[model samples]
Target: MDKIIRIGTRSSKLALWQANTVAEQLGHFGHKTEIVKIDSIGDIVLDKPLYELGITGVFTKNLDIALLNGEIDIAVHSFKDVPTKLPEGIVQAAVLKRGDFNDVLVIKEDENFFTKDAAIIATGSLRRKAQWLYRYPHHTITGLRGNVITRLQKLEDNDWDGAIFAAAGLKRLKLLPEKEKHIKLDWMIPAPAQGAVMIAALEKDEDILEACKEINHEETATCVGIERDFLRVLEGGCTAPIGALAMIFDEEIKFKGTLFSPDGKNKMEFYKEVPVNNATDLGEYGANYILERGGKKLMREVHDIEKSTLVYSTKSLSHDQTNNLSSKIGVTSSDFITIRNNRLKRVIVKKPIKNALFTSQNAVEALLNNFSRVELDFENIYCVGRRTKRLIEKKIGKVTHIENNSEKLADYLVKNLDTKEVTFFCGDKRMDDLPTTLLNNYFIVNEVECYQTQLTPRLIEDKYKGILFYSPSGVESYLKENTANEIVAFCIGETTAKKAKDHFKNVVVSKLSTVESVIKSVNDYFQE
Candidate 1:
């Protein structure tokens, strides 16, 4: 005599597909299965916006109630739709394998679609609305509520130019018409946990839970766990217009995240990949990295503007200094401060400077502050990367040359420099590559100690499942004073990877030098 497992799901075509998928998996374990379709608040209420409802559980409330009342044994939910905090007596039993997590743009084939201004799009989510508005505010987004079939039908009926939907949903339903193509990752990011199904069960149902475990996909579970953790830390809801998607492929896990203003006029995105072994810490680490880098300030400004027009600008000053300057100039500026305090130097210049090279904006700002009085009639100015080039151009009017990295800059100087005389303006603690490489080419490159970047004495006091290191300096600083309690280390670039190996031998190096690569590496490490 086997127990019958009642799978609860929303009464939508897509939800049925998810429910059926779960039931089929359970059936393999010799369990009798049945599906109980229930309508959620999100399904019934069509008139009002999600934010105005002021209630939290529009997507899960109905199914949850049914689960608690014993009408259903388990509830199948789109992982993204589930709230961070679970209700009493319910726990996430398992997560099935994830599908394509990218958002797809279904554009109608019409000659008039070439212009961006007159395009009309359809979407049901505020998250989608915010992102779309951020990127294409001129293109209007009409609310299209219904399951996948109904929404697509409305799009065809109204002759709406296009609609944005989760790639996973369309693929799961097998309803992507031949006329449309899947959107590329460069176009849009998907909702957090968008592709995965979360199985919710009564806390006491150990037997059914054990049976449900057979369907659980370890890689999908790990990646979604990290993505959900990011959403939790951001304090974002379905209406926040924040999107995050994680993928575990090869030996790495990649996380792509975005934040959009409420009206969708402004948006900031970040990507990180690390070994799968560090997937547990990927979300928090990735979120923190984005916040520390620039996303936090962008998010704050977006949140502050609400419906007002936003003007974005960048000035060389500390947050306090910027505030003082803005106040003096009769402009109300939102604090768009990043980790400025950690990575800049204060100095006074006395001698005439000849050659200057900048790797980071912080380095450029610090150099500018020192030479504010002196006219920099340099032989040549070398800048690393596009960001440093912009900073240099803003302050110095123009730059002599730009290279992709410090290594490339060194290579350029080695090939072209006939006279072995160049001074490098740099941080107090910097990589030896630029100097060492130049020296190998018989060029005299003086390394000036401009500023020092040190880690905070108090590291974030959370029990992270893994740790991420962006730079060799960060790794050295972190390891010099503090212990990470046996957390797996995910390193960004080669330098950071070397530093991690020096301390923790089993360091995970990202396939790419970017943040997205580090996140992907973390995903793959954990899945293994």
Candidate 2:
């Protein structure tokens, strides 16, 4: 009896179809297969943009986790969602035959919207958004996220003129609408591996590798490999408006790639055809062609729309996350800091702790991931910032003490705390102000480093009226690559404001220490 090969995939219809196709392909080679459904962060998170989340291969992360843990023998994935670089222990098993590699715009009605001066288009992709804006500068671009079925339904449901989607996904799922309803964006370059399905498996699985090799399409693999190699050089742990497509002719492979600013006003493009014999290093060669020119500078300068009242945030935020901001003003953000829970630190938290101190929302979230709200409902819950307090109140219990900054929180704790000792949960990069003050006051403080924060500063290519900042570290990160001397700084609190005042011309601290307060400060400052 043959051992059943387990295929892992997202529970979505497209993913299921891909998995079944792989299973059937494997079965053809005298191998039995089983489909294993796995949940991915990309599928669960519909609110945040993929790039802003600071996660590489958001769609493949969970699947990779599952694969690493031996939950499945193989994982079928949309190749484009997989990062250019594979995880260390995982290797690509096969690339299926290519499909129609073009983006389609599912329109609401007639083509009249295209001829109009201002139209509304929706897409979740940064590449699609930039290309569309380049072609139609006057058009408004809204975010649309979900599976193929959900997106098609959204196109019909929303008042927008159209929404962009992959033609291959629609065709694969049989979700493509009538010919009159959708238009193929022939001019736009598709993402690397856009229409390809890839099978990934553990590096040491010899039997799985041999089984998958039977289904691999050499031509498809070659084309996508070059395209992915191009992407690997250009995108280094960051997302950008980048697009590439590679085609194999009889004797030669032709490739075209373009990089654009976030708003698509500035672009760098390159096209090259290399003989099939010498095409192994074509991707790296072509990418260098763009980088040596203006591509490097252009990547750094992708700016916000200048004419509009745009505010750039150092942290990634969805429009819904900030209900306080008006629709008239455009808000674009990319996270400058990445935070993750520390697994080792989580273990240090024991039950029935009398008192707790949280400096940031990340710390609270990290601690809660290990200990539930009921278990963490201490006699006294002390935290800094209103948002942190709000989260505690909603999830855990009441906040006995809250302040805008660690300095203030420490001050409050010094005078009011009847308990001689407290456990403080914080990130690795947390400021030492509070800890220093506590120890100096002779208070016994047990600190648990629950999370870690890393700065990932990016260039702000376009001019904005103001920039919103949530942390002093964010300000430091932004200054590493770019400057905002002429613009106003909208800071979440006084500590962040202090950092901004050193760089920005006008620094406005929020009346209260919260994301909403910072937005309100922006509106109020403009109103005044």
Candidate 3:
């Protein structure tokens, strides 16, 4: 502890501040420290974005090399810049106390600053650049590479009106010049590990690792652990504009994650809070929840953007017009009227049915509307998907069975129940997989067509250069009526793409079966 420990850090002002702070903390423990300033690859590159540089240890690689060579006892870094995968024999020995992990906008003090259009903003991160451009497409973002002071100096010397920086960095260095304002979380999400400092040491250097632990903050470590774990599970890095932040208060932890399209036009945000006792499981649960809802699709699309892919996909169904399919399949003439009138009935029904099966929310809506006055006795309500489950619970009360796919739902009902008299409230042209799967196990399966799906001619003409098809029926409708010149066709899955390929020779099928996979495929195609 008496020997002077060499602390390696970047030569930047911000890195100096971080190193000095750590030195001060270590000094209290009677540990002598010497600072070693080094230049990182990130500091030298000014032409391309960080992600384009292939963001693996651009900042820490040199410091890590110095540490392994015994030139420095510890290497300090902005935890967010550190990669999840580290070089062998090197480890993040301790994470210093976290700071304000939020993105802040620093606009120059000018009379017309708030009203300016197409304001020039400076930023070095692709994640921030993509999100900002998506939100304010009119605003121009120019790359400003340097330490905090240097960037600010560049901002003043150039035509840039503002710049974005991590609030934690400014707060750590006390660099806010009173003219700058901090942006809120609603506007911009901070990068992962944004506000934390990491102490990296040789794996074999137990003395330095143990000494560094005295300064590690437990709450910061736990919260960052959860956030980093979420990032790791998502397989996201600074390159992908994914944002996640965790807040821990007492025994409760709240996590919020956002996935934005590379261009930032389409976005999905997820929020969930769990008790601290379940913190270890929080990352997986949050990830699974996002994937179930739509995060998986968004991620694939983001990756496609990086790979320069164009995506054209849709969720509409395709039908065969020549086969008199409309008549053979049950078609309701007054379907809209039925749905509208039933929605206004404000009636609740209790039917004494042994089993209740649902295909869509419309079924639950119809049952609640028409049979509201009737009392039906059912032990449980089974739904085909999460959306149907939520709808049933909202209208009819809690549902016991929830399945991800329709086929899975059918398999579940067939395996669990012994009764044959099951009532399936569904549409006129609903898929038969669910009923067919359950028919063998039930005495009598009753399917009541509650509504109908009719094609509308309300199509927008040739507005898009590409079309995305999710169902075969959608492809049929587009091919039957609309004629466009050579538009790229993208499908969500193989089943949809097969129908698309029959009509269009230029059909692209997504490798993954989900919506995100389709989007990614489209992006990759377009970019290519």
Candidate 4:
């Protein structure tokens, strides 16, 4: 091309490296190139996680603006960071050949973090965080944000066990530490388009777009296109913990996609192999298959979890708890926060049961898992929360009664449910008042150990204005790694407030025990 192809990119070191790479590729085509470094909002704000910023395309928005303003002919981006929808008048020009797509665990030499229970792991990606927790629920995940070198420096400066990084980034920058210091996390699925580099040019700039296409890798584009299509169909964008990959194998395309609950305790996955000729709609087909197989409900629950900001619940909230808050308050595209540092200890129950009582979804899941092992003739089922009721109803067809609290459930059972025998599925760490009330009321309660709540506290690297707590156990978990130095405590109810008051002077209690009320309390306190 006769005109100089100005490439716009973020000023970060890694971003400049990516821009230079594209410039080098275009140079081979006898095209003149100019590198323009720009600073994005994502790079400017380092205090909060990217999702909390309430903006999509945090890293590429500035470049998009630059390209539209005619300051640059083309914008280069890490394909994964670019929003699925491009800005007006801008279109994808080319996708360079992809690099290594695995996420690597970088640690100090001879580090014992992985072997230790509840070791601190640092990452800024929700996808990485969710997958890591799903595999190693015993470890705690802390937020790590910065440029490639800055994040590595932070890992060296802090006492954190280890941090995660993209294998492609390290290879591009040639900054991979010793083999002993980094371990390839092959088991974890990578984000869609993770290792690919993308270039965008205005639709009217045919000269630059045509020149860019000369270097486009058709195979790389096809693979990432399918993966991104799957992501778009699922509405994951950049917010949800969704992963998809499409690879051409022996004239066929093999695809794998995964979706996880916000807490990472539950997961759904789908895999398929199809001819490459029919690969255009493979992503969409895979998305629908997973959604039909309980992935739809999991996604809704994840959406609810993402709508809140820094909720520390003792137990994972049910779909109803999260959905109620999402409905009452607006869930922004960029505002989703959940910090679940505890894991549920799975258990087995072999007892015969006629009626089942459940206070949490964890309890209900335990019973559902053991239903096939034992001949359960459950005539009636009583649950304390809407999420538990829905779970049981999906499995057994119906729930006899559902209430907001255990006390209400006990009262309803005493007046309405007349089954002589009952089986209560409960956690090891549970409130004694509900079981005590039932045992004293002449109800033959056969307590079955369902699950145990294990605390895995994370290291708090950044300071927030306030912390939201839903249970006394949540308060206890937060205190394990941090103190209420200047931060306010927003509690779900009086019981949680009492626990927060022991350490924090500025403790505010919500009027009701709901996620919406807790968020309201936070807003009111901050607005003051």
Give the per-residue lDDT of model 1 (tens digit) for 465-516: 4566656666666655557556577776565676677678467877655444
lDDT of 2 by residue, 225-301 (tens): 98888887676223688888989898899999888888978878889988876789777666766765556666744
Ordered list by lDDT, greatest first: 2, 4, 1, 3
Q: Residue 183 of candidate 2: its Cα lDDT?
A: 96
lDDT tens digits, residues 156-225, model 4? 9988888999999998889888888898998887899999999999899778878989989999999999
How does candidate 2 fare on TM-score? 0.55
| lDDT, model 1, position 197 | 92
Candidate 1 whole-model C-alpha lDDT, 0 to 1: 0.68
Off by over 4 Å in 4: 40-56, 300-528
Candidate 3, residue 423: Cα displacement in angstroms equals 39
- Looking at model 4, the pairs that clash are 306-336
TM-scores of all candidate predictions against the true structure: 0.54, 0.55, 0.53, 0.55
Global lDDT of model 4 = 0.74
Q: Taking the tens digit of each residue's C-alpha lDDT, what string does model 3 give over 49-86?
A: 43453235678877876776677899999998887667
TM-score, candidate number 4: 0.55
